[model samples]
Target: MERSLAIGPGCRAAAAAAIGLTWLTVAPAAQPRAASPFRLHGTVEPIRSQLVTVPRLTGTGFGPLIIIHLAKPGTLVKAGESLVEGCRAAAAAAIGLTWLTVAPAAQPRAASPFRLHGTVEPIRSQLVTVPRLTGTGFGPLIIIHLAKPGTLVKAGESLVEFDRAAQIKTAHDREAEYRDFIAQISKRRADQIVARGRDETELVEAENAVKTAELDLLDKDLVAPIVAEKNTLILEEARAKVAQLRKTFDLKRRTEAAEVRILEIQRDRALNAWKHSEGNADKMRIASPLAGLVVLKTIWKQGSFGEVQEGEEVRPGMPILEVVDPSAMRVRARVNQADVTRVRVGQPVRVTLDSFPSRQFTGRLEQLSPIGSPSGLSNKVRTFIAVFSIDGSDPHVLPDLAAAVDVDVK
Candidate 1:
């Protein structure tokens, strides 16, 4: 049985209001929405970059380098542009260069979906250093010339020049020694020829004497007994003299040949030394291998790390400068291990430089490291390196500039 109660207008209005409030609360929860994309931070850098270092001098007893010339920072340079000049001295000195901007290039169409943060670096780069010498004990190199930093340069241009006085002097000395040996060898050969001729004359005379003695022996039977005996003794003496001369002649020839050979060896050694010194002198000048911008490296100086200056001393193999090709640039970034799966190779990305937030560039994910490294925040957390290749060129998109990257994962 249904029980009907008396209804009032106010009760009906209050019941309708309660039903409306319940519907409002549940309606929004039933709808679907999209998720936010993950973003990564990185730095803008050329894909091609190089580090320059002080050339490690080859051989022993090389003194310290003294900088005589240095390029000013921020100067545009091309390949093979002179950047520094130096010479060897009792004290040491150094210089450095830093590559800055790159020319614009065509964009790559491939894209990736993830964002990562890293520094920009060039894919192709070259490190410039002093040329290693071929000769030993030549003192330190002194900088005689250097290319200005940031200058545009072409391939195979001079980047550094060192004082070649010592090398030149050494080469001259070696040449003199080599020539002296040559002269001595020539004289020895001439003397040996003269001595050999004399010995041959004596040997021929001895043989003739032996033949005469043998003829005398043939007539021994026709002479008196005592005379015949004397002839026999004379023949024996002649034969003995000839045999001795023959043996001595062979020994003398061998001895003379050996003496000449010794001189030749000495001459060859001196010639080699001379050639090495000359080659080393030529190597004192350093050249760039590719077209790019010059970048000076910072080195320890006066108790602080800074740019190397002229008239300073530097050791061999210390990094001094770099030539970077800036046409193509890429950003290297790190992604959290947990979020790495959200990103894939070839995903499209948007890059914005922190220095110029108003400027944005498009790129694609180029590479994702297979292994993860410690994140430094927590022992359990790891981060993977991600490389993003920028598609278009921006003059302001220089290396080492901090940048933010965004990817549309949806």
Candidate 2:
């Protein structure tokens, strides 16, 4: 209070500085307190199934150590190999790779109302006939060689040959006759030539005798008148003789020429006969007119069914074989009268061969028989024939093969 104080601006500044230093030292020395720890208090609870029972594992050999290896759906498996392992009961139940085999799905069924059984046949076929042998007098010619059934032949190919023994003999005989006629004609011509020359010489001698008698008449003029009359009579007789000789020679020449003409006619006839016999021999061979497969025709004789074989005798104009075009084939099926109405021409059809079940063919109904006939054992069961034209060709598609035909309705 009573003290005297001399305070300057520096002294006031030093005192404030000393007060700030003292507060800084005291603040750091006093640290803040730590936070309190949290407390957690709870208990374990039991699990409960709602609206369903949760069963516990009770089977034998099935517990926490249970293990199983399941096979995939498309896994390759061998016989006696494990397919499902783990549960012995399950493994034994499904053993030996028990695969439920199922056949492949069937093809789509066509909208066909009915089917019929039938045989395969050719659409175009020709009958082979035995050639006619004329003027040879040979009947039922013997067959030397015959073509086997199922032989493919072309047009104009030789198919049959008849026995030529008889024909050969006939041809040789006719030829000899022709040669003999030619020789006779030649001989006749030579004789006629010689006979004409002799007639000319005889005519000249008769003319010379007449001339000599007339000269004797000239001598009679030098002698008595009675001698002249006798000479004239002798000349008349000689002239008459010459005239008779010339007439006789003309008549002989005409007769000889007529005879020669007759020989020429006979020769011509013989030549014609020879040519005819040779032609008959050539006609013994029969040729095909179309290209196709050969089918032997069935011949019924004496209650036996057979075909023309080699060494067999066949009559002229008889059917020996049939040539069928294998390219165009058809199915001839007999349908019941009740089902005949369902089939129509131009309808699509499905054909299957009994020999080859895997193969299938498509065709169209080409024709339907107008008349119905008996088909079954009883005459009351009548059937109508139906023809189907095949669309394509196959080697296995031959005539008479049993086939099944399915026709599509409408």
Candidate 3:
């Protein structure tokens, strides 16, 4: 019986070991825990990968993140909601004066909601070309004279003034001679003057001289349509010259029977001369061709006609100033080629810009490229673009939002 008990204990232990081994094998299969999900730490953006940029310092993380519109950080902001605060002092001031223009259509058109998923752009191929002013006879400035570098100008403002000092001196000398001739004639008796006929040529020239002085008064007021502020200083000296001429001279010619031909000839010559001078003076008025946010450009080295400063001689057709309207805002984005097939035109999408991280604005797929193109943020394989229209009402959409577009293939 004792032997039997010992064998039973051995049998029990072996059974227990076998049970333990079986339990261990089944536990792994029967009981499982889930793998944790990935948490993406980014501000709520109009796009998935990129940030919607605002003038507000943010998710760019160049320095520290500057939060704008703290109250609605992750909430829906209204159309006029002050989404950001504490911007650069100049930027804030410009908002009132800054204006944006919708691209004028070839046909007069009604307003339509446009699908805009383009880079914040300035030249849209249709903006009116900047005016170029060139002059002849004033003979291309013997010495270069330029307008002020950074002066704010009003509409019909003057930009630069040619040194008319030499012209003034010549006019003054002519006037003195004319006055002397008139004095000489006044001293002579009328019959003696007529018989001599020597002073007739002098008297005619002096009359013409007075007429030229009157023309000078008109030529002096050089004015341009104020294209924008900071075009240059107004042609103050030129206007003053016109004022001086008007204050000093009076010449009236009567159309008598014999002298009519001579008067007509003089009038024709003066009219032609005035036309040329007026056109030349118009060049001095550099006005903003369009209203927009003015950002001074400094990339002149790259074959670009950058911002022109006062005291710089600019030809007509040179871009002296720039105005980018804030209202012309468009959101731009990059998407992957691997996922390119899934994208199509008119796809609905959403965007969250880095500037207003918490804001989510809905968009529609506006454009898809016919051909594949290469992109930096895209995979090496050729990728296609998928543009979506964003809510234009949001002023936060000013520009440069590193936006990602989620195209809903479904």
Candidate 4:
């Protein structure tokens, strides 16, 4: 269950305004803004398709800390390696608890249940974003020390680091305490001191107790293959590509699926990894999830990164990547305020990019926003978001590469 992070109401307004403008040139133009000075300001926003912002990896409960060390920012390691040395003590606990009783299979889908289609990943939850490590307490996470990005790490080798001394101490402590608890339970059972699992509450309590103890171990360790290697690569590429695609989709996710959003390079990487890595998760990692040569997105910004820096901490869930699975690409642009009434789904469209000043792409109106509003930069003009899939492939065409689109409302 996760909160929906759709484009905000404000962003939607700007989008609507843009869509409405597309209609201004059609049928008959009774009004020509009458004047440019009074017309609200408008931006040629290259829309963004929906993004499956990767979820932050987090711990379940305290446990035997597992620490994996990497050599650098983006090191490639093999599965079954000790990123941080750990065994699934907590996982074992969870498994043991499951032996208690089988829960019903009818549990409704979790509010944010994983619904992966085409290539977009499920809402990330099973994977938690690990926090920044600063030589913390006894619990150790596998911290890899990579010499640099793409460094090849060996199978079962220690790539990520861990505080061995602290982790060892905790693990030993847990072992001793667990043994003591086991002894106590055995004694109680021998004397028939008290009945256990006699009531629902008792069974529930016992289950929780086991889970807590086990999670302590699970949290400390970093397990490999958190997700399948193929899927992990797809996710990595999708995030890495968002920066470029940001201009293409202009924040309208309804028309495009997440699978179509990974940058071209990343998609290539995924393809390569699948061909090689024998399906390894650690085989793919872009240099700093925020940067890859996203020259394509700059066209829409009139500059690269739209004033955002490589090292800046972006708001969580921003389209961190821009992808071009061209077969799935769409021209999602904003129509200006005075033209909202003229836009409609299935209306034919013509799009031309500033980068491709000589070329024009065609598509039909796939969607129109219900409301129109101002752009983020205090613009007087309003807009609506509209989307249309590209009819065919263009080698030079790219997401957010800028285009001049003419929609045929007729």
- What overall lDDT goes with each candidate model? 0.78, 0.79, 0.45, 0.42
- Name the 10 consecutive residues with the lowest summed lDDT in model 2: 48-57
Q: Report the Cα RMSD per candidate.
A: 28.4, 33.6, 32.5, 43.8
Kindly provide the TM-score of model 3 when superposed on the true structure, using C-alpha atoms.
Answer: 0.35
The global Cα lDDT (0 to 1) of model 3 is 0.45
Backbone clash total for model 3 is 24
lDDT of 4 at 352: 64
lDDT of 3 at 258: 26
Model 1: which ten-residue window has the lowest total lDDT? 94-103
> In candidate 1, residue 184 scores what lDDT?
100
lDDT ranking of the models: 2, 1, 3, 4
Cα TM-score of candidate 2: 0.56
Better of 1 and 2 by TM-score: 1
Q: How big is the positional error of residue 107 in model 2, measured in Å on the Cα after superposition? A: 36
lDDT of 4: 0.42
Q: Compared with the true structure, what per-residue lDDT tens digits does model 2 show for residues 122-164?
A: 9899888887766746788899988889999999988888998
lDDT of candidate 2? Answer: 0.79
| Candidate 3 wrong stretches, greater than 4 Å | 1-118, 122-130, 135-277, 286-292, 301-316, 334-337, 373-386
Which residues of candidate 4, in runs, are more than 4 Å off? 1-180, 191-325, 376-380
